[model samples]
Target: MKGLPAGLPSLREVLSRHGLDARKSLGQHFLLDPVLLGRIVAQAGDLDGRHVVEVGPGPGGLTRALLATSAETVTAIEIDSRAVLAIEELRQAVNGAEGDRLRLIEDDAMRLDLASLVPEPRQIVANLPYNVGTPLLIGWLRQAASWERLTLMFQMEVAERIAAAPGADAYGRLAVLAQWTCRADLLMRIPPGAFLPPPKVFSAVVGLIPHPVQPPPDLFRSMERLTAAAFGQRRKMLRGSLKSVGGEALLDRAGIDPQRRAETLSVEEFDRLAQLL
Candidate 1:
């Protein structure tokens, strides 16, 4: 078959050429499927004139697709030096027009302050490293208003949790936090075979558009603490589990039944409880 381009190699060729083997330690599972990558980029709605931030651009697979989109600029953050070298060709392929728009930052995404780095109207499009995905996502959600949207790929289980409804079994701390500040949905599922050194579990792409209005600032923090305590002992009733915060009185004040389990509560209920606390 044909290759990607003369300098810009296909995912397989890049992996073979650079000894860029997937490192389990880095949560590196390189996605090689162009179709799936294109779908993920498209789900970001309209990237035109928007600044796109991508994390862990492993071998520039998703990066290439992002560059091909309508985004005004694509700033890719990658910690792996090897991947940095691979993306150079991607930068070249774009040439002056779109290519000049690509900025490859060799740094740990966890340490970067996204809001300060990229100008307003930013959207993050990434196939995140599994090890840091949840923590990174939580950090971003804490500052949800900074970005226009987020198009991310995560393990299917994680994606389900992000898009889970109040009463569903998948609903928990993630669902509460994600939904409280953003409108989230599972866009599509990508099979294990789509990746080089495919992960054992299936993965899915999720889209999150930040809510225009966020919950009260203090209430957001309080809700996080409350949920952490309540779900820490998830099997117990809220009355028992929440005693560390304000006991049954808090639940009573929120008009929530103390007998209800944490998993059964809605995001609004959590917000009310936080307000009461």
Candidate 2:
């Protein structure tokens, strides 16, 4: 692992020099603690040969940590122009030591084709922007094979939804889809104070490693539709909730109880229902 280049400036100094403040419109909350940043990177497991992709790298706090790893490359995608300047400075600071290992892209993460951007053996690690986090994750899950692992930070509630079990209130479409495609876990809980200009809610990091065996494209689509109908009206019995998908007849076909609610069904049960579709 390459040490951070000598005389690298601190995150605060980077932000200050760039006159960058966390922007609520962009859902930006800069994580300024080096220890926490390192811990987040650790959650992604060994990065020795992985190409790390970071989104919304405000002032490149986590970017700095990633560069210190043995990761083959760290590609940061930032949409905010001002913050991009801050990260540019970081890129320059480490250019000598990191060489081609650090690449900065000033673009919106949601609009880019990630698979094409970062080749195989890729891992995504980021303190995701709050507003677009779930949407971005859902997109990635649809193409889970493209990534080796995903270690991301989100609001504590969102993290709970990702790792929640069948009987939990937090379990729903996200939990079903996420668990179906990958092994999801809430890795660490971070306090609001950990961020510069703290957010109102606590944040937690979630780690996801895709299962070796994944559903076929058709089955995955069926699963998405099934979860949408079932959790769309989560309080209703599966018979009523899934009426548009297939209703009680479909449940009878799959040997599931029609009276059960969406939250009560296991990932396997949902898969069973999806297969019938």
- Each model's lDDT comes to 0.86, 0.91
lDDT per residue for candidate 1 within 1-277, as digits (tens), equals 1113345667889887777898888899988878878887888987878888999998988888887777778888989888888887677666544445888889998999987778878999999998899989988998898989999999999999999987788889999999989999999998898888888999999999999987666777887899899888999999999999998989888888999999999888888888787
Alpha-carbon RMSD of each model: 2.9, 1.1
- In order, how many clashes per candidate? 0, 0
lDDT tens digits, residue span 144-166, model 2: 98899999999999999999998
Instruction: Show where candidate 2 strays beyond 4 Å.
Output: none
**What would the TM-scores of all predictions be?**
0.94, 0.97
**Deviation of model 2 at 151, angstroms:** 0.4
Highest lDDT among the candidates is held by which one? 2
Deviation in Å, model 1, residue 31 alpha carbon: 1.2
Candidate 1 error regions (>4 Å): 1-7, 95-99
lDDT of 1: 0.86
